[model samples]
Target: MGSINYDDSDVLDVLIIGAGISGINAAYRLHDELPDKKYLILENREQLGGTWDLFKYPGIRSDSDLHTFGYAFKEWTGADIAEGKEILTYLKKVAADNGIEERIRYKTRVNSADWSTEERCWFVSTEQDGQQKQYRSRFLYTCTGYYDYDAALKADIPGIQNFKGKVVHPQFWDLKEDDYRGKRVAVIGSGATAITLIPSMAEVTKDITLVQRSPTYILSLEKYDPIAKVLRAVLPQKMAAFVIRQKNIARIYASYHIFRTFPGVAKKILGRLTSMQLPKDIPLDPHFKPNYNPWDQRLCICPDGDFYKTLREGKAHIATGHIDQVTNNEIILKNGERIPCDIIVTATGLKLHVGGKIATSVDKKLIKASERFVWKGCMIEGLPNYALSIGYTNASWTLGSDCTAQYVVRMIKHMDKYHKSMVVPEPSNRDQLEEGPLLDLTSTYVKKAEKDLPKAATTGPWRMRTNYWYDLVQAKYGGYDELVFQ
Candidate 1:
């Protein structure tokens, strides 16, 4: 790729990519802590709130509770569980309230970022509309997330082209033109998208057939206040926020520990609860069962028993079997059953990629991300002045991102104090240690990026722990002194 035009008018202290929650929070922290330093937020989209703005599907609500998701300094005064639009609105408000909206450059996509050892800065190339521009910054932070915005997985079944009806993917939903009202639809996947979309679309569509190879463990929750409301009213905002966050974090961690320590006992308790919600005739054996324990993958959460209620009402049906092939207007199952539909929605998971196609190079030599071990899943070992904001698969993405961002700010502050130009994580024994894949084998993103990416250490949180509290203890407060900076 040719180099973009250089216009180095303003040399920034930090250049953040993707103005989503992570990037925004990072900017906020940097500005708050070090107001003298200059920073810029470059976003690919016309608007902020990366994932929230990208996904406009029906019933697009948060999987986790909102209190933990929002900023620690700013209290989430809205409802407990916020919808997609509400979240987007809140993000915009945050930018506006902080007076950082003007600092963001919209519709500008970063092509590549290269680090120079001599200058100790990053050369960032970005394209806006049809024009290209370049800049240099002391620090670089990526919050692009793992998935591709424009791409969605298409079903690989034979004769998919022969289908006469309109096919859609939730990732690429058309806001105008097409409608699913009063039409028979078949949604594929057992992930969060499929779980949330199936029951919701069933309300408008004539019938919805949920096709899945296996089952996902679903839990029901309600947006109500018995004690939280009383506490919030009685106590101060900061105090209330701290109390609620602590309580929720403890509860979630304890439950997860129980599930991990005693699988059989946890399964029995969870299985009984799930059985009580669903129909007795529905097979709970292998279909609704998982090979791994709960929280291994992510457990799908729903508000109330909407998913089960939809199934019981006969408006929606869950087909737990392998999809053999696509035959014109129907899907043929491996068990010799044909389910006909007018519209097919493939909510089949997302593809995960690190840095969102932004290549990293050191001294003109291309550095493969998969070849490096992640330091707290943010900084790559041996890379200078760069950090990534990736989220937890089990917990809310913002929770992990926020903690990591704070640590990065602190590190930067320390660098400023010591008069250090760059900070890199260099391993002591690069030859003795071997690297492994960053994610589990079952994750679609890991499978896709396995060949080209940096290999993270197989052990520790860099390889495993998806819990927020655990990551907080380890990354934020535990190993700070040990982290080397040069």
Candidate 2:
């Protein structure tokens, strides 16, 4: 196919926003399944691996095991749970190996995408370094995972600006020269970022205090990928891939079962294991206990109890209290205790935006995402020739996302046979459909948008199932006949 001109007539088969893991995988699947289609992956950043490239704080690693976190087609050859840098490298390798790197347009941010009813195409506008460009495509796939582009920083806290010390947020860490060696530091928030950063920074910092509003449940697990590596070595590549996938699915389901069937037993076991790692007298009550069940929100994971070990060794301290306000040189707690620090790191959670908050319009009528039902968590009701690769909060993100991508490929192939130009979710009776929140409100992202988000049917895998195996079976291999296409 010849390169089309840059005008309105330049039509593409697919236009993917966000060159992150989801977009990358979707592009790979498209290339492998339908080689004739033209696709482009647009990313705002100069590089690939969106979040992994953006976050470079200490002790950055996968919260879930690599067996499940890694790509379905690609086996994770590493021996342990992969770190951020390794994952980035793996992503780059995947792009190179699949020859999909050329399709990516970096430093290009999508501004808006409007569906043109007359043309039956999406008119996409993007800006790159102050210059605006436009493209039209038959399908627009949004893979921008949740999380706003801006880091969540609370720099407006009282006296925070007056502090005559170095201050930073993990999301905006500078890679050039700022060092934390032998300096007193206070890390705020107790989410995965804080849990990972505090213990890792404590090794170099003279003293570290972890300040939190509420306690988060932290669990530790071994990171070895022995079975993954062994299978890759002993069996054929395809067979090894199948074996690893089965093992990972089983492990994921076991954990899910434990959390569902025996909450008390699972909690007790996890708490006991945590207590065994902490200091003898450290209060585990209001400080370490969580109000909700595990996986309701993401359970904080630390490999090998590193955070507890750091606290026990006096290198780190957990301040299980509320922050009254920040003073010039210290953080005052609600109980009136003041902790002095030379540096403060705010590990506050991220704000999630679905489809990167892309503005969509049909026939110049603005389409509100919240008003439409999510079809398989990818395509939306009334939207045609479009799908997203959104992940579940409770499982490895890659697993669900990969499943969604595979489904998209299947749907596209099915469309190819009929010479179809578009696909959309069939309208369902609103009164008959059961409704519930699309995401748990406890999650920082979900809470922010709870008021305006679309409600899902309380039944069906597309509605509420967060399990990996069930989702794979239903989304990847089932329901192609049911989806409406034209």
Candidate 3:
């Protein structure tokens, strides 16, 4: 990628990538904390909302509750689990509320970024309306998620084209083109997407079948929190929300600890829950039982046993078997059983791409994303004036987003006070232990891209983690003594 030539006048204080949840949060933080700085947001997609806007399937919703997923500055008064459209609306409203919408550039795609040591900034090449353009910025903040937007992680099932019925991935479902009404639908994969799609599709489709080679741990949570409701009614909105949010955060911490501490107890409880949801005749050994401990994969849930109800009502079925092949109107199982269906929804997963697939180089040396370590799970190991936002795997995404955005602002203020132009965190002692995968998740997406993702230092700030509170302390105050600024 060649550089875009322009005069020195064309420079900005900050340039943000992707107008999703994290981008909006970064914009708002910069506006409030560093209002004098110039910033622009470049979003490739036509609209905002990021993940919520992209996924348009019938039952698209967040697995995490709204209380934690909602921004720290904003209190979520809606249902615990909100629909995708609702999340999009919330993001739009946040943008509008903060006056950040006007600074966003829609349909702008970033191709590459190069950092100059002499210039002390980044030169970014982008595409808008098939025309290439360039921009320069002192700081670059990327909130683009760690997944490929153009493709999904689909398995190489034999004869995908031979399936006579319509085939689609839930990530790209469109209301205008496909509808499952009166159709026998077969949704493959047992992850969060499959769990969310099944109960909702059962409403419109004649019958829905979720086929899985293995089982995932599914737990049920209440749709509404009575304590939250009472607090909201009794106290001022912010105070009440603060209390509820703290309680919820504590609950999440306790739950994750419990899952990790007593795998046997957790397994029994989850198994019992699954057995209670199914009919007495249905076997739980292979269909609902998982071979791994809880929290190895994310635990999915729906309000008040709706998923269990859907299964008991016979509107949906769970088939545990490997796929032999897909014929014209049926999916043959390796166990010799065949399922008749009119549609096949590949709810496999996503392709994780670090740095949003942007080609980055420093001083003309290519920056291999996999070669470096994550700096407190936000910045690249040796990169300066750059930060990335990725939320917690165990808790609400916004928790990490809010904390990281604020932390970056604080670092910026610290730099300004000291007349420093650049700051980067380097691992103090990486040779002490072996480098490990950046993420501990066992999900298909994580495993698929483990080799490509960044590594984590076993100790110090470079150690990537998943706990919100632990990360909060680290991001806010830790590593200040170690960071080198010039």
How much is 193 displaced in model 1, in angstroms? 0.4
lDDT of each: 0.77, 0.78, 0.84
Best candidate (score: lDDT): 3
Among the numbered candidates, top TM-score falls to 3
Model 2 weakest lDDT span, ten residues long: 1-10
**TM-score pick, better of 1 and 3:** 3
lDDT value, residue 480 of candidate 3:
78
How many clashes does the backbone of model 3 have?
0
Q: Which stretches of candidate 1 lie over 4 Å from their true place?
A: 1-8, 175-178, 434-437, 444-448, 458-467, 473-484
* lDDT of each residue in 32-118, candidate 3, tens digit only: 878877788899999988898888887788888889998878788888888888888998998888778888888999999988878
Candidate 1 lDDT tens digits, 234-255: 9998898888877766766687
Over 75-163, each residue of candidate 2 has an lDDT whose tens digit, in order, gives 77674467899989999999988877888889888878888867879998888778899989988999998777765634345567777
lDDT-sorted candidate list, best first = 3, 2, 1
The residue-level lDDT of candidate 3 at 195 comes to 91
After superposing candidate 3, which stretches have Cα over 4 Å from the reference? Answer: 1-9, 175-178
